[model samples]
Target: MSRYPLRSTLFFLCPLFSGLLACFIWAATLPPAAAQERGGGQTPSLGFAPRPKESAPDKELRFLRDSTAAAAISADELLEDRERKRVIGRGFADLRFLGKRVQADHIEVQTETRDAVATGNIIFQAGNDRIVGSRIDFNLDSERLVIYDAKGYLGATYYITGNVVRRISVDRYEVIDGTFTTCEGDKPDWAFHSRKSTFQIEGYAHLQAPLLSLRGVPAAALPYAIFPIKSKRETGFLIPTIGYANRNGLEFSPRFFWAINKWSDATFGVDYYEKRGSRYLGEYRYILSKDTAGQFNTTYFKDKLEKTTLWDIKSSHISSLPGGWGFSAVTDFASRKNDDRSLERNLNDRVRQDTDTRLELTPNLKGIPGSLRVAMRRREGLRENDGDLFQKFPHITLDVSQSQIGSSEFRYSLGSSATSFYRVQNKKTTVLQRFDAAPSVSLPVQTVPWLGVTANFGLRYTYWTDQKRTPDVPGNPSRDDQKQSPLSREIWFSSLGVAGPRFSRVYNGGFGPFRDFKHILSFQTTYSYAPAMDSRDRKLIIPIDNVDAFNDQNTVSYGIVNRVLTKLKTGEGFETRQLFTASLTQSADIAEARREQNLSANPRRPFGDVVLDIQSRPISLIRFTHEAIYDPYEHEIDEQTTGLLLEGGRNWYLGLDRTWRRKRSRGRDPQSGRSDLNFSAGYGLTRRWFLEYLTRINNVQNITLQQS
Candidate 1:
């Protein structure tokens, strides 16, 4: 058995010998290039790898291949030397396989661990972000880049630092013993520093620290914090606002946001006041589609016996209708809670029953394509005083018209409307109930020259029901039903204006004895007349109706005189233009002759007002106004007002205003003739410093000052 085992062992040894001989022959026959290709070195492989030598141009990037000071070197975008390779560059040098760069004065590369060790002004740009350090060790095989004594920018938004940094990904990193700052790059605030942080390159970060400094001065330390740097819909706790008020005392409001979706969101918050207890509020808004959107807000509070709250909700929708029509609707509602304190003690009197409603719809309307409109509105208020308590009956209106009605004559037509009033708080007052329908037809003759005349006719009917107090007799003129009965009437009228373009010219710059400056001015005039109306006198008038006696006339003489407009351009970004228009106006009153004789009063002077417009480029504003009222008959100024504004500069502004009035002999206050001056000023000295002042001085030296 021993001999047999020995024979097996010998057979195995013979093959092993033959294999060794074959290897020796192969190695002896190989070329020198082949040996070198196999990473063979002239010297025996040592535990320490040799360092690469520095390249020329002294300022270029070079690599250290070993711990020794001198070694062979390779200068390339990529270096692949087994002994070792390091970059010595003034700016930057990258080790490709290691997936790292060294921006340092000196760097040492090692093959055992396959890492580049850096020193002196070292920076590593890995992926999108970068890091700076006094020293660094980067591992190519592990794709791990680490730094010590580091500071640099994080994705361009925040300045970051850590005693050690281990980048997990292009967008993710782990920072130990770190600091965060708003200063970019290597700049330091010196006031703000962190102990530890985990940051995300995608606009968020988680921080953990015992204390954080502001401007390098310690403010407060937080155990943990989560911040979002991206501006978008994000859910988080918001900064709290705090203030002191006489009624609420020291109050703090903290809000929270909920990121719902791209089209909708919500916000909720709470108020903690020292004297007023706590209050909660919520607001929600969203867009349903391209043409539909709405918002709602509500607030609630608590008390012992009686709690008061208010909720407001509003919604609107715009929809495309069949044909070329469009539809729009808006709705709003408010509800209030009332209890003992609110009603009896008047602590919260404004919470009493108050409701307002409005609804409208249109089909094939004018101006708007394809519109017809039907709308109703009502409002009610409950109050303790008879004069304060009031109610509005549902006022209904229906109107239909076309945008471009006729070719030769663009005619617009309107249907009548109906409304009624039925309630009054005072028992001595009678309820007013009435229905009115007024239909009007307007035909405007037009041509390419923008000159034409128009004719209009309107018919109106009113049904009225009058009530009387049950107190006195008719002869004595006490409230009686005999004189207050129902009345019905129909009124008709036709109006015509032979309107054609009336053009006039004017010359400006006649002021300050400077006739040298000239300007062109234009004017237009319109003369209209209306035939006598059949319904001149009436037993009753429509409630909630705008009295149009101001716009009526037998012959209205209106001419736009001296339409003066100014034009100028300046490089200082301040351009001002003023347009002044004057017109003679009057009301058409067929019964004016009788009213003047019977009333025994001054005949109303043709009521007229001059229009003025001013546009300024510096402040980017347009103003339409009328300030000076001249009594043409008396040849004196009745009322005057002046207003001006200036807007420019980063933290500066200015404005001015003045007003004056004349008192009449019959009805005038003792101090009515005095002029009033009101002015306000504000300025921002710096980004964080602001100042504001307001003053109102009457003729009696009643001066008011406000500041911020």
Candidate 2:
């Protein structure tokens, strides 16, 4: 000690030895630089020794350097917020602390006039995304922080070390210019690079001039783009259609829809064809309540080529109408004028048949105007021959049955129609005002044993006028010679009785020789009377026109025909009594039957006929018809017709008919002709094939296939 220069020797030599020992101990016992500040402390410097920026070799810095060795910050202040906590290290302004406990090895810190920088190797964080980069920087006063070329980790996952930075109280940024992506870290096929980007502290980002490359090709390029921070709904346009059709040529349809209220909406679109022009359509729908809704849709087209117009309108209201009344209306109109007159030749003569208006109201209306029946209807038909005729018009009807007057067993209906008809040939126009009211009277008189007598009365009246036609023969007595009359009257009466068999018999066998078979016999009789008188010169014909025969008593004309049956058991089946079994028929010549004129001179008198039918198995059917003439005094056979038909299923079928006229001749080659025979037969060859033969010996031809 005496030889070395006392003060210098003690300062330099002793402190140097002490610093060496301290360095050795720190390197051995303390945690790594990253571990030293792992929890909360001043981070140890690595890349560069902790040092304040030189200040012009100023007095204060020099004084501080002389007064104390650099103020050493402890590891605790390294991880704490320097600005908010207002905590500072005074003993050491620039600090370095190497640690032995944590995993990382490198740590760094630098201080400048306005900021402080800290950087190090960030270790693998078990649950967080891993990043690897070069460096990180932080501004103390501004509380801005940045990481540069810093590599971070979570387990084995590591990202490219470019930037993973957060500037306190400022913003965050992940520089991806040199970034590589790998869903499988071994061999990545895609990469991303961006010139610059801004990211919110909350984690959303806006990138600039970003390029996404896949398999070495530029997948996407965006000058600027924004990404949503959360999931949300989006609005956009739809794709248009492109297609072609033969008649319509090239076609295109563009459609769009808008969602408006929760209960209502609309859609509109257009259909365009290069050849046929374009059409537009729109639909609107609304829900008035939970149970009721209304919808309307319409379409229209105006052809540029032909100047034709077409449109359809439809409106419907569902069960939601008031009082459970639903309404529907459809109106469609179309008119097409041929683009070229020659085109009409290719199509059928096009006559438009369209309904001008169609309205349907249902279920006893409450929502509709008046009642369920409060409606007006109109329609027209167009035909080449008819030109234009009002087939139906605006006819209105109301429910008048609230004053329900008819019996429950019967119904009373009253209706009227105003209509017009145009004749094609004569070109005559006729207008009609028609009224009808039918109240049917039915009285069922049950007279046991005697019969069930029923009386029914029907009344029908018509008032009309005709533009009378002048007869070709001026003096002819035919109806054509009569002039039109304004008024007329007709009165009719009908009465009938229904009777049952009082006595019945069954014969087990024959009528004569080979005619033996099972037979059933029953007898019944029905009587009817009808009289009609009218001053209407033109007598109205009914289903049956009554002719006089056995008159004075109820003629078998208006009601049921009277008959007694005697069924005979025969080999071919039971043979019916041909005499009594005939059709109950009346004459069409009302005036002639009324006079009942018969005699060689007046032999063309009206006649009444009756026919009977019988059928028995393979022998088929047999019919016998007899006509009785009325000469206003006597009844005799005027005409008789017999017909028979036989069939054996798929094997064969045969039919024969004969007719005989009964007009007296008086040597004039007989006023009436003899019987004419007609026959037909069919025989099946197989299940689905057949042969047929037919003949009308005295008349026409007829033939057919049976099993085809």
Candidate 3:
């Protein structure tokens, strides 16, 4: 045996094919533990097809019966009573009726009533189902039976045993001193034993005085329990949870689910903490139609320790409407301010201090796809004293998709937006309204299989109804600048990108079961030029967001992409996969070089930081990735991330990840730097033994922020 790895590569375009094929259905007798589709379907377990009238599980499970045949019976010794319409058999008697069979040592049957009584070594068989008992009473026509000391096997994977068991109806059974197991071996790995129990074949079960056992040995006992018998979603109470936390003391919660209907469901639960009172949690999900589905989750509680109320609500919705329209929305809101941590919530959510709610609608404008979006956001802990920073009360955008220009290679796209930026502090308010539009046209051409070239030209126009002096600038603005109204600005931009000249080589070592290996090297280049804005015009711009901090870019970027591909041997054939990939890119600023040349400065400004990305999956069970950004001027790796994942065997899995960012100067914000290490691993010592561990270490920024 040898290790083989599976791989995936991202491709911009690929060919797809679809064809219609003639097909037929076939019946198979699956293994004892095989799964099936129950509820009104054929069992197919007893090496036979199903009868027509047995359409619902609520009806009898019957095999195919001969239409023009008579009842058959045989025994070593037999007796008949014509007057009473009775028959008696002794010494291993056997009877066969319509889709039913029975065998016993002594048997008596009534012809008119279709009833039978068997006492010695009785065995009854139905559609893919069999039962053994000492004494049995059955109705042939109704397919109902009762037995004493019954041990039964039903469906594909279930077993039942009881002192007294009755098949009240189809899929419903009553038992006393019964046991149920789905395990496959002669001795079940686990089972549920109960004194009084009722089982529904495709639904759930209710057990009284239930005892759980592992490998036939009792492990735990519960006063009452309910278990879902099928794999599909079912309306029932979920398993209750219990645990202890340092601040919450003891915690307990039990959840109930309502199937509502085929397309919707809801789950509700109440969490009780010994020292922190109670919390209510709920979630609702629905699918109104093929194109519509949504979910909402919420949690609320009144804290006893803080004597305050807390809540968190979230929702996500996506639906397509008539008239070539599609809609989606998401919302997140919280009440009060705290860590938002409880026994029921993850501690990592404590870092959240801001939320964004957005609504969007996509339209097919004369068969062209476009989208309109409205969003609002709120932020906290942005100021030194930890007050309010800024809010986008309602930002709007409409963007049109890029499309071909009427049988030509040229393509065009349009984007427009409106936004209101507001800041609140000390009962004073600062507000600004900004509007902008940007449209671009692009041409893409591929002259050869290995070369692609694209050129783009765009114009951006912005208008502002409000303006405010930025405090960070060197000098105060004149009165005339402050009084300026309805300011607007415009700019034209262009860019070019070339991706081509892929170099590749194939090595034919013909290693064991492998055909060969292929390696590819490709280059990508992009250049953009934006004219610098004069100081007079720059002063008119409002100081908000990245758009306000725009800088002239006369820069060119170069990137090299490397990829390795290999074929793996499978039972049937060989399959190709990507074994490794790495990309490196760096940029040179021509504008900075020209500025330094006029100043006649020595040792001109160096190129921008270098970025490196690498991914390797040498074997099926191991993966590694590394990413880093290095500053050439500072001669240091300013940011880096490395991760490794492994699965040694069935029970030996592990992962490690490290991320760090460096702040080069002391004046930089302390919170801008981070060094975090995360590790998680779990292993099974044996079938009955296991070990697991996980941890995270944050080595920077000791600030404590609050949220609710």
Candidate 4:
């Protein structure tokens, strides 16, 4: 193992540090290499046995392992001299000792010194390393070998030829006038020419006075360089990306990957914006066990033109805790309001409007027949500098599974949570503590095939501390409000939900591939009322979240959902799929009798807009979806979205979507002009190759918003 087991990285570094290769040489220091089983350490005795005279004249001789040494030798002829304790072999001479082998046309050895000399096409082999030269001088005692005019390869990749290759010691080597390359064939794609190079087996390779050539053309100059060798991932410079963009000019990004260990790794790089500035990026990943893993990625950039610095970060973690507990976390954060627009590198991530950071834990509460959860959540707008943001911390919740009420026709479930709410808008910040609990029960009053009725009722109690009556705004509090006397509120709420008269029909499909098709329809309604609080009482409650100011919702929401399911027979079995789905919903606010619209300041009629949604999948490959909101007063669609999709399970895909709006705009909100069409398509040329195209066009602007 080379000091850097990922030696492939050196192939690129050698060419990059060509001129400086001669200035650096690392002396790798590691534990000594393992030696073959031997009778004695370091210097082992040597023994030689010659072929018997009675054997055929052309038959070669073989040596037997004896007490003197565990070495084997074979040759066409062998001669021994007791006076000098020397042995000589001629013709096809081979020697194997201490896990190393040597082959030569002729060989001579001094058994006393444990030194050997070989000439005429000498070949040496040790471990995975092999070398061929005309002559060699080796010391079995020191296990040091030097080959003259050597040419061979290292680690199955570095093909090296040198004037003199010498193994100074076990796991250490030096080569003079060496030229090496990773490319194969008679002519390599590129090669490094160096005056001298040294190797620390399974560690690093150092070269001096090295020059790189690409396709026989000199590419770079380096006096010296040190390269770490590791498998696959390594600590080294990676291939750089270069391109030209009108906004960024000539861009170049260089990256480096560090394989910290088997379970962890990291990558650091710098992206050149040319016109803007340089951006530094880093990512780290680690796995502690099969169920534990985490990763973090971050970026920092300072724009010269904009004269602003920006930062972005992303992280995710999942782990299994002791005692049947699980934990996970996710974060996407930006230091600046528009950091996503200024610094986000991912196309999809930049289009998102907000960043959500959350951490959650699920624990097994002993003897509890319900799930327990603890979590903290934060939502930040990517483009909002001073809008209200939600920050909930230490939100603890428990959900008890529905259980029978003494074997009665009624069952009940309990759900409750306690949370600390923190909200910030502009320069003001609001903080409050909230505790809520709700327990609900349902009775199956009717269970006929055509008419089914289920009635549900629940009571919810909530308490808020450190609260201040906020103005009638979208969760925005002024800075001075924090100084006002804090107040607390204890509120009670109730809700009722009913479902009945669900209709269904099954149609035998003698028509397409569908074996059977069924259509089902259901109607559901819920009425919720919270004691209407006076304006002053409501003001005592800070609107820190969507649910905070809503202690006065005397409203009812009713909706009908219908589905068409189709069953298809696969070769293995049968599968059911919802082929079509549709829903229409609307709600009336009776307490207020009028509610403001999202984009308009004026309160509208009590009757809310009717929202209709439909989805149809006639076949496995084709799908269609549509949604529309009808304004009762305007008698027109206030907003609409529709899309179609065609899927090719393995090779192709197409999707087209359009969004339209009639409402006016609010500050910093998404534009609501003419419909915008988004189209995307992809086709696979081969199993491993594909091409895709995507574009978004704005009809109002009459320009392409985005295309790729």
The per-prediction tally of clashing pairs is 29, 49, 1, 35
Angstrom error at residue 625, model 3: 1.5
Q: Please, what is the whole-model Cα lDDT of each candidate in the order they appear? A: 0.49, 0.40, 0.68, 0.71
lDDT of 4 by residue, 1-708 (tens): 111222333333444342222212222221221221122321222364432345312212223444344455656677777899888877777777666788887889887776899998777877667778889998654568889999775554456789999988767789999877655445545567899998876677787867876546777777665665322445665545555544567777777778798889888889997788899999999999999999999988888877777788999999999998999999988765554353444677777766789999999788777888999999886565436577889899988856778879888888788898777667578777887777778777666665555666666666777544355544455655543454544455666666746888999864466778898999888887777666676766666555565566788999999998888677877788888999999998885564444526555477889999999997889999999998887687778999999999746999999999874667633445577999989874322234577678898778887665
Task: Order the candidate numbers by lDDT, best to worst.
Answer: 4, 3, 1, 2
RMSD of each: 21.4, 33.8, 12.8, 13.4
> What is the C-alpha lDDT profile of model 3 across 1-708, one tens digit per residue?
000111112121212100000000111222432111111222211111222344422223322232223344556667776699778777666666555677777778786776888887777666655667888888655657788898766543357789988877766778899887655445555577899888776655777877766556776676666644443456655544555655677777767777787888888889998888999999999999999999999989988977878887889999988986788888877664654354435544644554446676666566555677666665543213245446776788888767788999899888888998776543345577888888999999898999999999998888887654543332223333343367777887889999978999998766675668999999999999878766576775656666666546799999999998888788889888788999999999897776645455566774988999999986778899999998888787889999999987645789999899987568886446788877878764322233455556675754322211
* Cα lDDT tens digits for candidate 1, 9-51: 1112122221111100000111122111222221211222323
- Compare candidates 1 and 3 on TM-score and give the better one: 3
Q: Identify the superior model by lDDT, candidate 3 or candidate 4.
A: 4
Judging by TM-score against the true structure, name the best candidate: 3
The alpha-carbon lDDT assigned to residue 305 of candidate 4 equals 73
Q: Report the number of the highest-lDDT candidate.
A: 4
Error of 3 at 613 (Å): 1.0
TM-score of candidate 2 to 2 decimals? 0.31
Using all chains and alpha carbons, the TM-scores for the candidates as numbered come to 0.52, 0.31, 0.66, 0.59
lDDT (10s digit) by residue, model 2, range 1-708 = 000010111112122221111100000111223332344333442122234455222333222123232322333323333455322332112332221011132333333343444334533221233333344454423434556654332122222334454433332445544443322222234444566555443234455665655445665554544432111111112233444544456766665654566677666778887887788978787887877777787878777766676665656665445766666555543342223221111224233343355565556644333333333443433333323333323333443232223454432333322222222122434333322222334455666664555555544343334322432322212344334444233333344545443333444544443242333233333344435443233332110111111122234433233433455557677565522422233433444556654555776444444333433232234333334332333444555566666767545777777666654757754344555666667764322223465444442222221111
Rank list by TM-score: 3, 4, 1, 2
